[model samples]
Target: MRQSLQLIFTLAFSWTLVSCQTAQVKTAPEETASASTGQADPSRQAAAPEGGVPELTEDIVFNLLAGEVAAQRGALSEAYDYQLRTARLSGDATAAERATRLALHMDKSELAVEAAALWVELAPEDLTARQLLVVMLLRRNADVPVLEHLKAIVRISENKDENGFLNVMAAINRELKRESAMELMRKLVLEFPGDPRGGYALTIAALVDKDFAAAEREANTLVTDHPDWPKGYLVLSRVFLAQGDKAGARTLLADAVGRFPDDPFLLSAYARLLVDAKELEAAYEQFLRLEKVEQEQGDASYWLGLIALELGRDEVARGHFLRLLEIDGRSDVAAYYLGRIAEQRKESQQALRWYQRVEGGEHRAEAELRIVRLMVATGESREVFEWLQRMRIQYPDQVVRYYLMEVELLREHGTPEQVMALFDTAIGALPDSNELLYARGLYAATQSRVDILERDLLQVIANDPKHADALNALGYTLADQTNRHQEALDYIQRALALKPESAAILDSMGWVMFRLGRYPEALDYLRQAYEKLPDAEIAAHLGEVLWVTGERQQARQVWQEILDKTPESEHVLEVMRRLKI
Candidate 1:
């Protein structure tokens, strides 16, 4: 009789827990709904007052209560074990779902898979159960089962308003391997041949997998079969772009926009492609059309503003950016561009106000730097230095950057001694900073302090052995300021090997070669460097070598071109003076 009474009490307790859990599930949010006793269907709840309470045998009662008690006490492992056992023994959908959620919470993926499979078996009509199972199977790379459940989901969703194929494709695109996702979509297309979404999914998957030929083939078929679908043309254009045929992409998108004149996606693609191809005028016209078609004008306005700036239409650019200032999340970016336009218009105070309005985003740092520059331009150098100090304190992570900016400002407006003192203070603060050391070394080279330059550059190279810039700078300095021609050659050779295509290193090699009296080799390297980077310094080097090699006509032409472009080029002028030309 005592044992019987205990059993009755346990049963009553189980029924109470089920009722409370059902109530919570009905009211809880989706993310927290899984924390309830089980995922009970509304129909099942209506059919039974206890919400489809499973048969409460002694074992079921003990395990269910144990799991609930363990979970409440923050003993998730114990709860998961009891819940999984209860699910297996009772074969209850609710128990299985609870076990699955518990295992997932514990990050026991394999155990979650086991419970999820059971839940799906017991509740084949439950979409949530199927989705959970699909995720678990995908995590395990069980492609065959994943495909089966995905097909089931599609069939189930056909009766509903949602497109299950697209939903599954999105999920798998993030979770599954690219090739595996592409193959699965291919099979799904074969399974649902009449569904255009399947073909589109396959094309996107193939594109993501970088199988351009397959993507092109599928995209072509989609466009041919569904000429009314604008996405087909968009995907085909992307395939051409993936294959580096930007001209083909531009041509196809042009035709697509002609066909679908008011399609926002197609029009936007065509406009952006034209911008990339540097056809700014045509892109501006397309973006104007896009602005009309698009309900939200943020993207179109942003691109229009940039294109106007590129086309030297500051007034037009300002109008677009001003319009964008009214939109959400665009105020900071719009303010930054407005600041740039103000600077271009020589409205220093207006530019300062606009830049100050840029509170955050990718442009905040640049905006601040511009503000400092404007301050110096306005003869507020003292105030600018004070502001930089405050900024350094406020943004500790950007201390090095602030110091570098200060160094540049001092170099332009203050004396060379001030710049050197600032570098000393920055190096004291960040004793191990390689960037600071390298910058100071470059500045030292400019000051003709060879000892300081060598010490600082050697420190940087010691910190980062593969610092090609430091190696090249050291090499060029030694060759120019001292009689270390062979040592300079060795250092420059190492730097060249590290960055074979670096124009700066190539120029260093050419200069060191000239210092060693290898005029022909110097000419070759200098020519290559000048071709790579048409800087005045490099042109000066190339011209000097050409003149020494008796190519006076070519040397004069090179010097004339650079002088016409940069009349204040000291390097070219100094070379001409030294050569008595």
Candidate 2:
């Protein structure tokens, strides 16, 4: 019943707003010009000041007529300027009002601010001028003076609605002292005892202060005063979420949703909460419902795509994102997600183009970094060096990617001193990064630096013993470089156990067994790995193992098979020719 009354009141207020132009007593210039005119002069009816001829300015009438002609003919900038001159010359309220609106329409912010401020200065009590002053501050920027001015208007406003009071109170809270904002609101509530806006303001203030008991008291008052409204219940839901009671939050939201079933705000927030809880399947259902009800909302399409992607429905998510881009082609978020999907598919050019769309938007820096990393991965990594140099200058502390890229660069082409510098930089910058530690361990093992490799790999295995790559690296390095056959076999077996079907890990296992003089077991694992991944490394491992398994002819044949494809197999040729086959 209270919501119905508020709606009726809103309707009545809107009617009054539309009907109150008459209530404001507008003095039309067209009427005065016609009243003063005995006859229309042919030259005074000339085209315009800038076009045909200048009008005979007997008074403000001629100026207004000329200004109207200019404004209607796509001369807004000139029209505003001329109207300002005319209003300044004659002090006409009607002319000043039109000039202020026209200046704003022309995107002349300073001129609009000046004219509106002048109007308010002339008539300090003019509600329209005072409201426009507040609007100016809102769009231009927020400050303490703006909040105080807005509060003054709220105090003097002839009427206040839920939205109006909320706007003023929110602006005050953002742009002024918090306590002052609450006190100003309390004064308004005391002034207008009928409107529930005061009680709502108190609820917001109490919520800001973290005084939940006071906020709940004020919210309960709003609920009692405006039983049909959903804002009161919405506030209560936020209070529950702030207090960390998810069940209580859900209950209050369900109540608000029951009351405001068709409200997009309620559905949007509820859908977000469901998404946050990792219930993607249920969240997708809610997004589908929201889209069914309102297919035009970008948020609905975006959420559907997000939930679909999280649920592994890649093609479905892609279609939804494409549709969303069609609806709003410049959405940076959609562009960024599409770029990531393209990157996952290894469509480098498509990924680059998609990321390029949001180059100057909010996601530009992140997209640029991703593109750099993709380039580095493809062996076209020279540009990443330049980007890293520039990033070191721009963002010295925000270390996300440059560290990894630097390590890769050093590994690719750097002296021992420079490589050690990268290691030092990475360690000092982020000592706890598992990937960095792993990188250092791999680099040391590749260079045959056994002491560093042993130290780092021991640390890695201590932290994550089942790390398959670390196991494979340490085992292969040990077996190939030293007489640590038993230790190599132990590490390789652990790695193979963790990733039994992994082609690379299986190759490492076969190589370690071959080192341990277990020819048959080595041949079996190598052949199985070759069947799974017919790579050059697998072929070489299987061929070397075959020679030891007493299949010299088959080993030679295998080595020949590998060389026949491109004639570039270093290990294959070494085994066949060095063994004198």
Candidate 3:
């Protein structure tokens, strides 16, 4: 019986080899090129040897069969053992590579290192095997072997190409600690004194380590030594930016762009910096130059469209986005912008058509929301609600967001009762959603349903005790509507502690202080809030505190400033009516 089973297994294994021979033939050229040049092809997987079928002894056949069976049964550790044994006995690089990958998948780091070492030994000319060994050794912090393999990789590379050094740098950055990566880069730079890539990599490593002084020194040296290299100047600019010298960085990039007028990278960097500085016209010009210089114009067109929009050149923006639609992977974004341009032009049906064409990408949800708004604006409220319901089903991950949008739409176009009913239904469905509870609480506060507001806000606070907005809202409601001065102060203090820079929390603290009759403290907090956010409600609070403190003229000036901006300001009018001003 055992002999019969062995013969059956041997025949099956032979058939498997026959089936894989075609694949092996197809991959031999790539593997041969990679082995000769030490350039690793990521798509090249281990396959049957190119020479032909080897003499598979009983041990090799049995181990190969057992490993495959174990792997099929989800016994990865057993599979690794069998495969490693097969690799050792048969001296097959393919078997060794498979064992290494299996061990890695099982997260057996020590076993993976052992298998990778075997793979490198069996196929010393294979750059991928050496790279894998380097990564495994780096994970184990075996610096000596890691350095040895890294140097070997560089030596095997044709004419010691900088790509080998860059690949090693990437591995070190990903696997080693930041300090260790920096140290490794320093050693690589010293090993290859005249290699510009080594110095650039070291500068990047130092920048990532936040050793700005080291980064600046290395980047400056790189640019001075390699004056013709654009990347050195780019690194120097990054160093400047990292050190918070935006003007210096911008000036450096501007000079770089002048020197390398046809370089798309330099132009893109300078244009982005100009955008950051709000120099929209200058940025738009740079992008226009980039659009001409770049072979692939999608990125340039996208930037030109955005900068044109910011500059209020709607027709120019529209032209760029329309051009972007011709590029692959950019159609959705272009469609979204075209919709925005149509909306700006008040071409509602055209806007809807463009928005509907946005089938995917980051803008899909925003496009759907815009479509809903347009429908409501055109008095298709019933259709809008039906579409939102279908959207909730289609995008399960965004169900809560859709529910919130529905509630908002109701608040705008429907009635308060409808909004409240939708909130209740949404809460029943998403009982664990803190956002829904918080929104409903805020809405309840608006309607003066203090009991419902307290219930929902307390529920949100119970779920997430660190909900600063809920704490602030509940406290502000109590201070504004009821006489629970001490209770309101406690909650507001907690909220203020959580978000010390929140303007809303500051306003709540001021309101609570005013309820407590601490007029001077109220004036201080309200002034800080108003300075942080010059909203009409905050201005109202600041003016009232000023009026109470006998600064009536200054209070009137504050109110008048906001009223001039927002002529029908409800908060200002209500305060004036209450104070009989």
Instruction: Give me the displacement of residue 540 in model 1, in angstroms.
Output: 3.8
Question: Which residue runs of candidate 2 sit more than 4 Å off their true CA positions?
Answer: 1-121, 124-152, 155-162, 167-184, 190-196, 292-294, 382-581
lDDT of each: 0.83, 0.70, 0.83
lDDT tens digits by residue: candidate 3, 1-581: 12333354456566555553332211123222222122333233223344533455555565667666666657788778777766665567777798899989989888898889889988887888887888878777746546777877766663544467667777767788777777776776678777677788778878877999999998999998889989898989999999999999999999999999999889999999999999988998999999898756689999999988878889999999988888645889999999999999999999999999999999998998899899999989899989999989999998999998898798888899999999989999999899999999999989999999999989999999999999999999999999988999988999999999999999999989988999999989998999999999999998998988899999999999999999999999899999999
What are the RMSD figures for all models against the true structure?
A: 7.9, 20.8, 8.0
Distance from true position, residue 562, model 2, in Å? 42
Those runs of model 1 whose alpha carbons end farther than 4 Å from true positions after fitting are: 1-80, 86-112, 119-145, 152-181, 493-501, 510-534, 542-581
lDDT by residue (119-146, candidate 1, tens digit) is: 8887787777888888887887745457
Model 3 residue 453 CA deviation (Å) reads: 1.2
Best by TM-score: 3
Clashing pairs in 3: none
User: What would the per-residue lDDT of candidate 2 be over residues 155-244, giving only the tens digit for each residue?
Assistant: 556354224566566555654466666766676576667766668768877888898887878888888888777777777767777778
- Displacement of the residue 417 alpha carbon in candidate 2, Å: 5.2
